[model samples]
Target: MALLFWAVGVLAYLVAVFHRQSLSVAGLDAAERMGVSEAGMATLAMLQLLVYALMQVPVGVLLDRFGSKRLLLTGALTMAAGQLVFALSDNLLYGIAARMLIGLGDAMTFISVVRLVNLAFPPHRNPLLLQLTGLIGQLGAIASTVPMIASLHTYGWAPTFYGAAGVGVVMAVLLIAVLRDKPSGQAAEPGLKAAWTHPGTRLGMWTHVATQCSAAAFLLLWGYPFLVEGQGLAPQTAGVLLATLTAVGMVCGPVLGYLAGRYPLRRSWLVLGVIGSTAAAWTAVLAWPGHAPLWLLVVLVVVLAANGPGSMIGFDYARTFNPAGRIGAATGIVNGGGFLASMSVIALIAIGLEVFDDYRLAFLLQYPVWLLGVVQVLRYRAKARRLLAQLDEGLGEVRGAQEPALGTKALD
Candidate 1:
């Protein structure tokens, strides 16, 4: 039963991810159809992210109040409407509005699904389930690559997006029928203050910011163009690379999950490792004298693939520290970190591209954001660890006292 519920939640999240990443493969076509410049296209992606980031706290509050079922259903319908509008749009303004709607809907999904996972699964099972959720959800991104590109080429724009929107509507109907808020009479706390007060939440947020933004920026809008135009790869080859990015992430998700479960104390180290690897990979590609070799590009893609799973570590921090009632808001706050960072990177890259006409220059902007995030992660990791130690000491004392009372009762 738990698996069945989780599967449905995962399906909704999968569809949401597909909608989120659909624009990735369609960048050039969207530019052509909307008759917009690269910066203009970036605006579409940036605005979507902005909307998504801005909505996280509010949506978290709503999720706590209404439960995952209501939020998931609404999210699906909203995304379906946005995709329909985007499909029919012929100008930049309409595209912006459509993307905004899509962003709004996208904002409601992953956190809700996460809440569902928390409700349906056992505590020990959550880390693996969460990773599996991400792994399966990334299949949506994989679909958005070659399959989406092929669809755009075969059926053109409107019809393809119309089909995409139709999928969302169907998911909405399924959610109405099958999804539930909790197993039975589960209660949720509705305060954001408690979640926000914890150092672990902040640590998770910074971890997310550090780990996720670069990959999000790449996969969201810039990567395909960077590959095709900058590195001079063929469109087909670029699509394959993008697909490989998703595939690699899918492969890494479980391994990271296992590591996270086994080495909860060392999770921060794992995040730092992923960040270092990402920075190294990007530096190698961007600093290469000319077009990087295909193998080097492959290595870069493989490294970027770790970002998504690494970011999931942030959520584990939130889950570890917060009470059940506060999980939704805490997850929202952590989720916002990456998107907020990605928004800045996306916007800056857009401006850089417009100003310098160089992908290398645009991507260089990722480093500062990364540096800032790494610093914060270190700062908050220390604070969170201190808090956790105190918590453990307090818990030990309580258990120590209770053990004496139980022993006396047994002896009597």
Candidate 2:
């Protein structure tokens, strides 16, 4: 059962990631065909990400209320419609709308897959499993660059999208047949209210961590390109570098997960992650333009690779606080916050650059974002430790109080 679930999750993600990278490439082709400007094309790309971020909350809710199977099917259909729209639509507006649909569908795939893996695997194995998932997803990205370019040249963007949509449908069907709502003997109909209303759930899912994480992720995705573009590198080189980042992250993810499991101290790891990420960002700044040496490129790759650890830490944080049977919502909230932040980062950077075309300035502005994330994670760690101490003391009192009740019940 675990193997079956794992396979489904991997294959589905492979298709989704491939489709995602394919769209960006296709968008360029389509944009050229339509004579859209670079800025206009950028806006279209941002729109898809923004919509994806916006849908995270609702997608998470649907996954929580209904099982992943139904939502997966719905997402797949919506995604297919979006692709069909993109492939066939004549106007930019239609393309935008199609991208929106794709975002909606694509957003559902990540959290759903995470939740499904969480359900399928044992607790200790979750991080490694997620890393493996991340690795597979990276292939989708890796394909996007040279590989996708090659595929596009041979097949054209239209056939490529059509083929992707076909794969999405097949994945949806497999999801329907293989996926389960919950493990056997677990609650068949767990109330959403009961599962989601706890203090931990409310705080972790709704506030603090989710938003910060979202912002950081968004910064990485949208901000990185702008940073490179600002440095005067060709889009192809930037894209290659971006792909390298994901590739390293994919390889490092499992290793980090393994270390995280060994340490079992989330706070220390988060501190280290913050340090590494900060260093990486600064390294990126230093390596800008002609300064980008081979050694620095390797450094960027390793630093960018730290995203794996950062993500694992985020997942660990979510799992600790998420109420049982509510992993989907928790996963959604966590990812949603990151995506929302991403939307904001992309927008804010665009605005900043308009005034002062300085990529370094934008990069400098983003350091505080990573620092903020580190601080928040640290605060969470401190508060969690305190709460656990309180709980332990409270348990002691309860046990003391319970002995008398037990004796009385025995007498009765």
Candidate 2 structure quality by residue, lDDT tens digits, 1-412: 8878777777677766665555544545676766775445556667777777777767766666565666667777778778777767666788778778878888878777777776776655666677788778777766755566566678876776676677677878888888666523333235445434433333343233322332233223443354345455555665666667667767676676666555443334544554556456565755576556655655655566565445545555456554446666556555665666555555555555556676555545555555665565455445545555555312111111211111111100
Q: Model 1, residue 7: what's the lDDT?
A: 93
**After superposition, candidate 2 runs with Cα above 4 Å error:** 23-39, 176-239, 266-268, 271-276, 283-291, 393-412
Candidate 2 collision pairs: 214-337, 214-338, 215-341, 218-342
Least well predicted 10-residue stretch by lDDT in candidate 2 = 403-412
Could you tell me the TM-score of candidate 2? 0.78
Clash pairs, model 1 backbone: 189-325
Best by TM-score: 1
What is candidate 2's local distance difference test score?
0.58
Instruction: Please give the CA lDDT of all the candidate structures.
Output: 0.85, 0.58
